[model samples]
Target: MSTYNNQETQEIPLVKKFPKLKVLPHVNLINSPTPVEKMMRSSEILGGMNIWIKRDDLTNSKYGGNKLRKYEFVFPHIQKKNKKRILTVGGLGTNHGLANVIIANDFGIKTSLFLVDQPLTHHVRENLLCDYYYGADLNYSKDTKGAVYHILKDLVTDWSSYYLCVGASNSVGTIGFINAGLELAEQIKKGDIPEPDKIFIAVGSMGTVLGLFIGLELAGLKTKIMGISVLDENLNSTKKLQKLIRKTMNRLRKIDKSIPDVSKKLFERFSMNRSFFGGEYGRYTYEGLEAIEIARNDGIELDPVYTGKTFSALVDFCRNNPNAKNETILYWHSKSSVDLSSIYNNVNYKDLPKEFHQFFDGTVEIDDKAVHCIRKKKN
Candidate 1:
């Protein structure tokens, strides 16, 4: 709701490096140059590296996160094409779908969210309410098969709609994070934080990781991308990352030929750690909860679904790596920092469809011990 979220985009960093990138439509969904600061207590507690955080969580006042960055490029382009509606897919409590609805609604464009099932938690339930609160047409897809049928049906039924893949991982939306990488480079030049030897972040749909990877590459930074896989291997593989990197890089090239191919070196600079994933999407792990508790002491809130698992990997790296204490580390806090207490309290779960009631009514049992604790607290 801040005035800056709607402000005009004069010259983003991506365009600064390659002027031709200005051809792609962009709208400001984030309060850019999001703060970077050292995690002093976290550093001392880990007894390792001087850990720093890129506060991307504060990207917007309404609903900040890495998702907003993607929408910055996506929403404006949707408007340019005169799309009347957006159809997207995600888990039943996907922050990505909720973000899509909230920001797309601001543009007066309707959103239809086709949701598949994931392990339920209070965070997921609140996100579902926000999706409905923001005027999204919601469908409770029991699984991917159901989601596909509904999406296919909707596409045929709704001709004026534009469909975006999960997490907006396609070439266009991916550009926003590329811009994010460049944004980080600019911050480094300004001495906001030291050049990180490694950056830790969550990898779900893979757009964020690929974008940052390419963006850092484009910025000529030597920072390695340590992606924590929050999903199954089939969805978060290096091969899939490469494919999207290829698509996003090629898209940038079409706009500016001066942009170099960073894909060749991506393998050397990128590593995916799947140990913290705890076997499935949305399932919180023991390590993730410990990470959440550690981050909270530093005044940072990370979700069990994404950032918690991510920071856990970062924590483990600091504790386990022999060179960790000698290197400068960065944790890209990608989850939204918004306090949705009022929003969750104001919206009633009964307002959602009959099939959706189970998530809130406690019929859907939480499979993870860490997630179950939060479910009891209802935070």
Candidate 2:
């Protein structure tokens, strides 16, 4: 039932709006109301809509991303349940796993990462090392089936642990994005930025988009959400997100009965784009790399698997709907913005588990010629 902003405590916008929900436990992992600014150069270059950026990337000082926002609700839930460790699964370089470890450590909880196969890249390698550096118990699961097996086995052996789904998109974790939606409403009311007609964000494990969708509707904003799919259509489809949203709404209603059921507004305000998925998860596409270059014009760094693809879809929309005057577009920058060079500097690749060495060694071919991409600008 407490929320902390760094050293200080305050009521989140969601709690302020529904005082009854203030009893729900939360721990702040971010600096609230992440800055929103107009991407002037990007707007002029892209040429259709007035582009704005919601800097969710700066969610924290160490490592920040969309996951940090989710952790706001997730961390407290783990503690309330009295779980001693978090058992989660994701691709080898899961930002969620790393974020989970970093935040969970603060709460004195252990993390066990059941990592499945993904395209190997320097980014993936660095994350493996950082995961070890940060004290995650790395468990290599060859694929999805193996990851599930490991999770099930761990849950049985370790009675105090629980398996949270990927990206922490469950009902409780999703309250983070609901908070974000209300936060954006406050910013718009204060004239920090214009109310965007549409907001473009990546759809991964489905929480971010669904939570934001409900939040905006609850705040009575006319802004629509376009969730560019970064994962498989099976998981990121409209049907799946709607189901999750309903579950989240049910949970919120339990917290506060006055909260309206916005299920009817789902179609009006939400759209999911599976076109940008790059065929499979973890592999970067040409369109996404190009989007990364375009984003650099606005001084934003985006990874291809998620934010890059999402931004590509956003650009396409602006081009496709040219001449829509008075319409503003907001790009949700969800990747981490903090520089982790110092963390990398202190850790040696050799320190990670032996199974992870292939990612750094020449044995594994870097996916998408990722080494070249990381070293120099993509031509």
How many pairs of residues collide in each model? 0, 0
For each of the candidates, the C-alpha root-mean-square deviation to the true structure, in angstroms, is: 4.1, 4.0
All candidates: TM-score: 0.94, 0.93
Tens digits of lDDT, candidate 1, 18-43: 87777788887788889999998899
Highest lDDT against the true fold, candidate: 1
Q: For residues 71-93, could you state the per-residue lDDT of candidate 2 as single tens digits?
A: 88788888889999999999999
Tell me which residue pairs clash in candidate 1.
none
Superposition error at 376 for model 2 (Å): 27
Decoy 2 TM-score against native: 0.93
Query: Candidate 2 lDDT (Cα, whole model)?
Result: 0.84
Q: What does candidate 1 score on TM? A: 0.94
